[model samples]
Target: MKRNLSSFAHPVCATLAVGALAVLSGCSSSAPLFLSDGRATTLVQCPVGSDSCSQQASASCGGAYDVVRQSSASGTLSLIYACRAK
Candidate 1:
């Protein structure tokens, strides 16, 4: 008896194509890693066990008179940072 294998191949190819498209889209998507409203400053640094980054962000806030804390996502990042006034 003979059996056909083309049906299995079709699903495998489709899955691979979808995965490739996802990877390519992830690579090509362009968005800023940092952005701030006019009231805050941007800081890129470790605030590990301290509030250094947030403090600097506050100081760089151009006297906006608001309390600042690092965004929740801040600590999850593994990168050194700089400051920018808004």
Candidate 2:
């Protein structure tokens, strides 16, 4: 009896192909990278203000000095940061 390719083909091989494609697509995503050039950058933790927005704003930039917490970003600045860990 002849075998069906779909049924005979290895499921693991198909799964690996799909996973590889997903990883490739993720690398091409236009989101954001956590760090740059590998330097010690300061993520300014601005003081909480009267408007109650200060806490929110600072929370946005909460991670290491360069980490982003908020949606809106300001002027670009040079940063000397390590692969990670600010």
Candidate 3:
């Protein structure tokens, strides 16, 4: 007897797609990581050459911040910053 494998494949494919999306959602750059000094740090991603990253850093720190690192990749600008003291 031949079984219908197509029907089984649909559910498996859908489950995998949903799982991938869920995992990707958590990979957002907006999520902040804590520094050893208890300062809040995060990777800010924005359009290449845009001031959005700096703006976000300032807002996140409420004024100034230190750039731990900066790089541009795949037409995206990224800045790793830690909030500065008040």
Candidate topping lDDT: 3
Candidate 3: Cα lDDT at 60:
80
- Computed on alpha carbons, the lDDT of every model, listed in order, comes to 0.53, 0.46, 0.90
The order by descending TM-score is 3, 1, 2
Compute the lDDT of residue 72 as modeled in candidate 2. Answer: 29
> Which wins on lDDT, candidate 1 or candidate 3?
3
Score candidate 1 by TM-score against the native: 0.36
lDDT of 3 by residue, 1-86 (tens): 77699979989999999999999999886646788888877888999979999999999888989998899999999999998877
Prediction 3 global C-alpha lDDT: 0.90
How many pairs of residues in model 3 come into backbone collision? 0
Model 3 C-alpha RMSD vs. true structure (Å) is: 4.4
- lDDT tens readout by residue for model 2, 2-84: 87887757886889999999999988936334444644333332323332344333444463333334332353332222223
Worst 10 residues of 1 by lDDT: 77-86
Question: Which scores better on lDDT, 1 or 2?
Answer: 1
**What C-alpha root-mean-square deviation, in Å, does candidate 2 show against the real structure?**
9.0
lDDT of 2: 0.46
Q: Model 1, residue 3: displacement in angstroms?
A: 3.0
Best by TM-score: 3
lDDT of candidate 1 over 1-86, digit per residue (tens): 67589868999999999999999999894643443553322334654566665555456553443433434454542232334444
Show how many residue pairs clash in every candidate, following the order shown: 1, 9, 0
